[model samples]
Target: MSKEFEIVREFEVDASPEQVWEAVTAGTGGWMWPMEEPEPREGGKGPFGSTVTAWDPPHRYVNRVENVEDIAEQSANQLDYTIEPREGGKRAWVRYVHSGILVEDWDNQYDAADKHTDFYLHTLREYLTRFAGRPVAFATFEDGPEASKSAAAFTAVGRALGLADDTAEGAKVRARGPEGQAFDAVVDYRNPYFIGLRTDTALIRLFGRNHWGYPVGISVHDFAPDADGKANETAWRGWLDGVFSA
Candidate 1:
């Protein structure tokens, strides 16, 4: 029999529950994934072909992924988001849970999910603080290396961006990746968990974390909706692969 696993994370943000709810459900201010916002109703379609199992505005949301693209026949998963008012309604507390079964390779799968959950939750906080109530767009490109090798590559990318030991919000940031790929932005938020950058045209966030015990990945968020997403994604994936392979 395959073993079951659950990943849970909790954090507090200095934003109202309504604000957080908008970000989560409507994607009015920001979104976690690079896809269109799903309808906010039970049985509504969600990202990655998942279905919304529950929707309680400003309080709770749930999604169950029964049909994945490639692994549909192998696994099952669900995600829950619970938000509550905190600090006299000046802030919000969030609890996130991702639970599922692994038919094989439970350890590695669970580790990847755990690390990614942390990074994404941190991204949520960044969005709430810096870009709430603003329209945003996302484009994600896959076909990168595996998680274990990807984390280390991302740490180096962070170093190249001068994110080491610097937590000054509003600081100027200029970074260049391989093949003249560059980023020009102001530091919007910074902590040990993640670093967020805002450029004239976009908001970019980078996270340096170990996924599945290998420090080989970096995840980048570009918060712009221009026509250049495909080009940028190609360049970024190539640059990242080079950085990791070297």
Candidate 2:
């Protein structure tokens, strides 16, 4: 049975409305996946073969994908962003709505997607706060080993990273990656299912999908002017492997 689901988020961020618009439309890679810049007018190309239904800069943007042949179980998908200026235009009150239909495992899929929305939005704020308009080298390690599929996987990861169970956001953290890579960061965002670390050069996202019966994964957004995405991926892959194999 197909079920309709809508995930809504409304929050204030430390960026102007225009900056928020840029992050969602042209700067997704700094926080989420690398997305090509959308055309700045209606009826233009959007990510995932979606079509831009509305394009109002610094205020509203919308896109929709319908009936793509290769995308199974989903008949349509839409993303809408509404940005409002606040604090005398120094900050933004943003609303994000993702509505779609899922045909199978609706509960589990919606749960995972809902939680993902929180982490991604938190990453967006992280980008706007520190790395706005910076060039980003995005890297993702998706091929997790069998060990990362267990429910204890992320707890094990936190232990390896030296993050205590009670670690809270905004706490300064110092840890060494499995490859001896150093991390001296502030906890940017922390929830039971996700943790974000903000260093001078990168935003590190640790996804605890094992709680939802999926493999844990990691992503990095390097904002250095000469950041290398491939090299970052290689290094993080080694780190992930070392953590899980221990």
Candidate 3:
């Protein structure tokens, strides 16, 4: 078997290659270009940013451990990244390849890749969108028209639940008091990340993506309602199922 292997990652960002190049190559928004620590000048051994090798300009950068042999043979552990302009600069393509594995680090390869690329793309997107000087998250929900209630519907939802303190600001919900507790509370339940809710009595929130992702199936859960009035069992599951189907 080869001492070094191949890992390639590609992303098509909604940015011109030049714009991407700037970020990739340590341009203004690129992660490494401006740190309290000095940035590497292309061929120098980079000390900061996405990779140990300082990001080069114009849409490309690589990271590595200080010791190449720490993970593999002297030449096998280097990670490389390339950014190339495609479609006449209208959009850009990114490529990253990691070479060398001490084999001991094999278990962590995917994790490392995710940390670098996923985080990078998210940060890059935010920077670009902000650079364009407009609101982003509220407008990109499910590829549909922007709804007036999209941004601040938290309290609007509580009122519809028949369980809110109505106020000009919106519906306000207080945590279950110690005496009112049906089930032992663990964490705050207001987060949609922990529980998806129906906006009104009619609409269930469907998650398709996040600003950093277009997720199809997200893993989130909470217990169903019980007579105790706390989320514990699935006593009302059938009703919920019917509501969802209807």
Residue-level lDDT of model 3, residues 172-210, one tens digit each, is 333231123332222222333112221111112223222
Q: Point out the higher-scoring one by lDDT: 1 or 3.
A: 1
Q: Could you give the candidate ranking by TM-score, starting with the highest?
A: 2, 1, 3
User: Would you estimate the TM-scores of all the predictions?
Assistant: 0.73, 0.94, 0.38
lDDT of 1 by residue, 149-206 (tens): 4435555666766566554777886766548667677887565445567676555555
lDDT of each: 0.67, 0.86, 0.38
Q: List candidate 3 segments past 4 Å from native.
A: 1-6, 27-42, 48-79, 102-105, 132-246
- Per-residue accuracy of model 2 over 12-115 as CA lDDT, tens digit each: 99999988998899836888988767778999998878899999998999998876546565677889999999989999999999998887778888898899
Q: TM-score of predicted model 2?
A: 0.94
The clash count for each model shown is 9, 0, 10
Error (Å) of candidate 1 at residue 114 is 0.7
Residue 167 lDDT (model 2): 88
Between prediction 1 and prediction 3, which has the larger TM-score? 1
Better candidate by lDDT, 1 or 2 = 2
* Ordered list by lDDT, greatest first: 2, 1, 3
Evaluation by TM-score, superior candidate among 1 and 2: 2
Alpha-carbon error at 126 in model 3, in Å? 3.2
